[model samples]
Target: MMSCSNERQIITNAGFLAVVASQATAGFLSAIFSIIVLRKCGNLHVHQNCKILIVSMVMLYIVHSVSITILQTTQLIRYLTYYDPCVVGLSTVICFCLRLPASVCTTSFASLLFAIVFERATALWKRGKYDAYGPQLGYALVTISIIVSLASTFWAVQKVEFDQHSVYCSTATSQTADRVMLLCFLISGVNIITLVGIIALFIFNEFALSRREFDLQSSYQLRENAYVIRIMLPLSIFQAICYAIFSISSGLISLFRDKLSPVQHKTLYTTAY
Candidate 1:
């Protein structure tokens, strides 16, 4: 059997490095992606609302990447140098440090995507007048998304009791701590719905295009909606996969945590990270 201290040593040296590398790579790619979107979409004259939604997503990705990198790298150095103990679940301090901000960015991005779907559907109800939609509507959707994200995030984590001074950490804390899984489940569910909603919107647009002819303006709007879906679907799929893994793994850990051995606990937490 491995000593507890030795197990910690192995994970700190091996795992944190991988975590840091992944965050750095994610950040770099997000920055490049943002630049490309700005350049290409500017040339294409995509509407202000579409630009706002796309830019908001890229910004969230960049922020999430930076925050995770710093949090992981700081914890990595601390564990490597004997300044912080490596716990099976993250140390309370590290979890507290990264939880809120990262979760907010994640929640906000998904919320914005949902808003896009809602806004497009509403625009269609406006029919020929959809062309008159203004940037204020875009701003309003973005504002609503941010507010809802903040509210949902607070609601999800309300039960997690953080002890800033405690080095001890485990899968089980307050009985209410299991509630954090709510956030994971909610985000995962929302992403899945976003995926389905966007696909349906695209299909509807294609069907409309194929069947009856429309005025030049309505046809252009329909085609534009479909084009936006093409660009956004890859992102929807990626987020869906990411959140599904997070929610499933976290749910499993919460449910079976009592049965897991120390090594199993550590392995699950590390992978979920």
Candidate 2:
């Protein structure tokens, strides 16, 4: 019969290998897509701000993918050498290190999407002026989001701990962590709201285009605008939904973590990270 320790070892190894394989494949594909988008859309003049925002978002995803890949690779290394799949460095340093990149990347990505929605709104309402300053506005929003995300994640990581003997790391149930989770929840909610707003705006634009009278040039421009919004809306909504669900689930799991069985807790923690 397999002892508990042996079972744990098997699980740890499987988890480590699974994370490594999945992260590597995802990172590779996302990197390729990022490169393609940057190359194809880099020089487009119209919707320049939107293009830049997309590239920035993709870059964040790439960074996140790389961070997770490095993390899992390290875990794989530890597993091969020490028969322990979890990282072996100082508890706080290694575990919280993962949180820093993951949180910053996720928060920044969501904020960028919000910025894109704002830009779209502005374009719809004030096409000429918004285009005049859209690129600058986009850049400013991205920069500010990066700064805030970094600060928040830095604060949040302080509450995370990695145990050498455990299969996964954990965030301490402290006031600080609670505050961080609240901030995350707020961001997720905002993302969802922004996505819905964007969808509404797109629908309004489509209705206006179909019903309102316009000259030839004006009609063409409105149609183009409507088409672009139609294409992007699905992708944006999908991202928002995914982010919202993940954030809500994580928050709930953390809140009720004490009630979870050991295996369930470990599974959730591993999957979350």
Candidate 3:
């Protein structure tokens, strides 16, 4: 059994390294794109909202990179310490350090995405009416989301505790924490769906307008709307793909953890990384 555990630990370490590499690459790309957008869109008042979203995404990527690094390292430690009691305490500490930051960043990203999508939807459906209240409503929503995220983090910290002897220290027994996590994921998914739908509607509307005899200004507005979709479409796709990869990997790891031997567990973890 001990030999099997040792073998698994080796595999898990390799997986952790892979996750670190992927995350680093993604973070770098996100940061570069964000800088480019900020530089190129400086004079475009029309793209001001998009610029804010881009900045928010950049911030999310930064936090995600740091938190994932800590989480992966701690997971590696947990795997390696299956037979070594001395290292478990350090592993637990690393996990504790990572969890809150990861949750906070995830929550913030979800909130920003929701705001961006909701605002775009309203703009599309109500047309000029959105202009009247968009900024104020967006600000209020973001503020509320942040407050909720912070409060949830505090509550989670109070309810969750480390197990000195176990590798998995998550407070899965806490119903409230689980519910809060579920709510966050639900909100994120809804936001993504809403944004995708709005983008589609905008594209269709632009096509319809192009076929009709519209005023010059109205035609220009349609063109601008199409341009926004072009930029946002790629970003939305990237985010969706990232989320899907993470979710699938996490689900498989959890589902197979109990059935596999220690070495297999480590191998799976490494592959996931």
Selected candidate, larger lDDT, 2 vs 3: 2
Tell me which of candidates 1 and 3 scores higher on lDDT.
Answer: 1
Using TM-score as the measure, the top candidate is 1
Could you estimate the TM-score for every candidate?
0.81, 0.78, 0.67
Better of 1 and 3 by TM-score: 1
Q: Point to the candidate with the largest lDDT.
A: 1
lDDT of each: 0.67, 0.64, 0.55
| Angstrom error at residue 155, model 2 | 4.0
Worst 10 residues of 1 by lDDT: 164-173
Task: Name the runs in model 2 displaced over 4 angstroms.
Answer: 1-20, 43-45, 84-90, 128-134, 158-177, 211-221, 259-261
Clashing residue pairs in candidate 2, if any? none
Predicted candidate 2 versus true structure: per-residue lDDT over 134-199, tens digit per residue: 468678777887888777766765554444333343343343457677767777786778778877
Q: Tens digit of lDDT per residue, candidate 3, span 13-72?
A: 555446545654655565566567556656554434544654565666567665665555
Q: On a 0 to 1 TM-score scale, where does candidate 3 land against the true structure?
A: 0.67
